[model samples]
Target: RTYAGLPVLGGDLIVHESASGASRSVDKATDADIEVTDTSAAIAPSGAERSALSAAQAAGDRKTGAEDAPRKVIWAATGKPVLAYETVVTGVRKDGTPSKLHVITDADSGRKLYEFQAVQNGTGTGQHNGKVTVGSVRSGSQWLLKDSARGGHRTYNLKHSWDETKKGSAFYDADNVWGNGKPTIAQTAAVDAHYGAAMTWDYYKKVLGRNGIKGNGKAAYSRVHFGDAYENAFWDDDCFCMTYGDGAGNKKPLTSLDVAGHEMSHGLTSATANLEYSGESGGLNEATSDIFGTAVEFYAKNAKDPGDYLIGEKIDINGDGTPLRYMDKPSKDGLSYDYWKSGVGNDDPHFTSGIANHFFYLLSEGS
Candidate 1:
């Protein structure tokens, strides 16, 4: 993945090996190009991000919040790899989804080479699971939102901030009572996030026999109340955590059980297959999360939020009580496709994902 001591993109793969090491095959990131280039920026780095952002905006890519310093990399998406700068910008999208935009600029020519979204916005649940229990630990007198049994997993509060430097504060309670199932209280969202994380964790470990999101027995963190009036939840592999935004006036938190499972499963996909987040592969990436998320919901079997084939039913993201996505018939959203067409990959991954979502429903529950 390196050429002249710089990282090279589009040169990775996912190998599937049987447990006995008898069967093997390449499963992901197979579009590698045999190209190499030296590492040297021909132009000044001051205007790289500005240029990229300008182009992104002109193309209707909006709501950019944080921009990362440009980093030199060997771009292999082209037949010939050349020194390029990759910049990642984080913000909330117009659909209330958290966004991570990657802008690749040719270092020598100062030409924008490529761009893609890294954030995975997904639908999922539970202002709607009734009162639930979350694992907590006490450090002296104050009870923490951390759960040690589950790989010492912890939850934090972003307080509507998207600052990358800050990891956010931990939720502390004197009596360890946590939230009261109300959205106004700050602890309320934290409870949902913490419980959601716990449920997702238990589902993978107990049902799937996986240790954690990364399968290394370590847990990913969660942050709640991210951004002002934010109405979505997202998973950014760069952050190694799941973030939930308060929906519609900072009152409707998107930290449902299924939502947690969906976002966290994104981490799992990134860790394992890491399917490119565009075209048909991108759509499959999202559907994989949806499949596992629904599995987690069923595994929980919580009486308040019973398992169902519906996605985002509890969040009311559409202003009505309609679920964000329908697995049985994706066209119910009026935007998704029930089956593949010639140019389905051209659609947003969220919409194109309906194809796989529908297939999974039929495969799992059957027509």
Candidate 2:
């Protein structure tokens, strides 16, 4: 029988149902116009096999031929759900910084398609460079960094807030000298709960079809300015929220879309497929956030900040007029690795973080 609107290919196998209420597989290579076989199970596909077959069929570009592939005799035999959808985040930040993040998720279940966070912004901080935390939009958390000179240790808090005017929100420096300009810490988180919360809420609802961090359809919490010149942003599952640091030397804020999305995606990762951190898995975990964060920017569709593949495009950490991270090729950063190889140590979690970072680059950008 002639099939219209179908992509037919040689070597393709298809099944046909007869008037007798029976099904059979017919190999296109040799079958007659109307040939019959027996039993769907005799030609049924198993989950593991089905995925391979689907991939092969897709690669073969046999869109029409595969249409007739027999349905698994049993649903289990058919294949894993093809719920994954590719999501790409592409745009440039307001200051002309390039940014982009990619994600893959189960289209039906609304599960993550894929995630990755590469190094976006970095500044020298003791043994660690400036860091970006990717986790849930949790709430009710605080941090206290040592201030021996102050006699009394400095205390910081984390809270999530919402605002309609800024077009975005953040976990800001509430009490830091740099935060709201109290002038105690020397630097303050430029963006506050408004930006962080805006990113967290926007990314999930817009890209992943998720309700919130919990996927229960609720708002998240955030806090800004957690310490004296605190130089980082983080999301802690235990705390269930995020915290930010005041900029360094009056440079930039830690609440950009990539940073906020990175932190928020961490929470989503923890909630589902909690990929282990510290090694290859850890890198994958980090990349997941970066990917989602970039996507969030696109989903926002903010004309002011069109999305792109670069992370931390605005908050210039290097001061050399370049992005903190490049998803198309992460090695663009002077420090970040392009691909995985030997000597890639387990020493620093972020250094080792390159493995998944590379994986995501390949997954989203394609090798």
Candidate 3:
């Protein structure tokens, strides 16, 4: 329930019911005042909207659009109740990235309070393990790329387009098995990605005791072949999905097992710590994903791609036949810092991640 359109916390309430259906309740939780005396706003709705748009613009949002009127509500999340106007702004940046931001402003002062992005922007394998087992759903006479056992995990093929309106079709086959252990066939990459997702789910469930990425027993989906000549994979929070791209010339796909785990771990990080993607915190964020990605690789114990401290060893993103990064001795790559020092936060996350990755490697495997 809410008071003056503000959420009321029930953490302090205790209710007792008798056999006659009479109920008694005691309130002991809230001590802060919830009254709002300044209902008469000094700033108009247009002012609030301007403040929100200005805030979004200051935060690097371009092509900004917002609601004409802000909604009045009580914000009790901070334990201090305050009347505020919540404004939602949607737009894309100069880089072609989309943004859906919610801005909160003081109803009376029109001062911005808080804002957050709605889209979560943040995979892998094969040439990977030889042959792997995957969980799939059998419908009629077809084996769909849906895992019924793990909250119905599904994988779709985007057919090299970035548009979400035209969703890629789900992979289905006559046989229960998938992938040919090669990248020549499109299904081969899908097989590796599907298997990687399953292994990641198992790793979290069996090793960490987490049911799924969100720990809510819900499985996220994956989209393969995201764009043309694309050589990357990413996890999007908005769709709760992981997307993979085909490497140069459309021969290699970035769907290796460790890559899958790495991308999925980003989702886990966002759902949990939400480590800011910049500065020292951003380094920690990238390292967290690398740590878990390595863990998942070892957990799978596939012979073809044995567990190792190197990342993307199988993908060979570099034409020189080298992994994207190294953990055992990060400096081997000639760019990553093997040890922490002052101002490490200034470095790119991929490079700064080396410090934590090295530490985790030493902690888990030891020198």
**Candidate 2: segments with Cα more than 4 A from true spot:** 1-193, 342-347, 352-355, 358-367
lDDT of 2 by residue, 59-79 (tens): 332221222322221111112
Judged by lDDT against the true structure, how good is candidate 3?
A: 0.79
Candidate 3 positional error at 1, Å: 40
lDDT of 1 at 231: 87
Of 2 and 3, the candidate ranking higher by TM-score: 3
Tens digits of lDDT, candidate 1, 1-367: 5766778787665678889986588753435554544455778666777766776666566776436688888877766667788888765556433456788889988899998875432121236576766667666588777766566678899888977446799988887677777786788888778778878887887688998998888988998888898888999777789999999988788987788899999999999998999999999999988888898889888787788888888888888889999999999889998999999999899999899999999998888
**What is the alpha-carbon lDDT of model 1 when measured against the actual structure?**
0.79
Clashes per candidate, residues 3 or more apart or on different chains: 3, 57, 5
How high is each candidate's TM-score? 0.65, 0.46, 0.65
- Tell me the lDDT of model 2 at 214: 78
lDDT of 3 at 334: 91
Q: What TM-score number comes out for model 2?
A: 0.46
Backbone clashes in model 2: 57
Over 4 Å off, model 3: 1-126, 164-166
CA lDDT of each prediction against the hidden true structure: 0.79, 0.47, 0.79
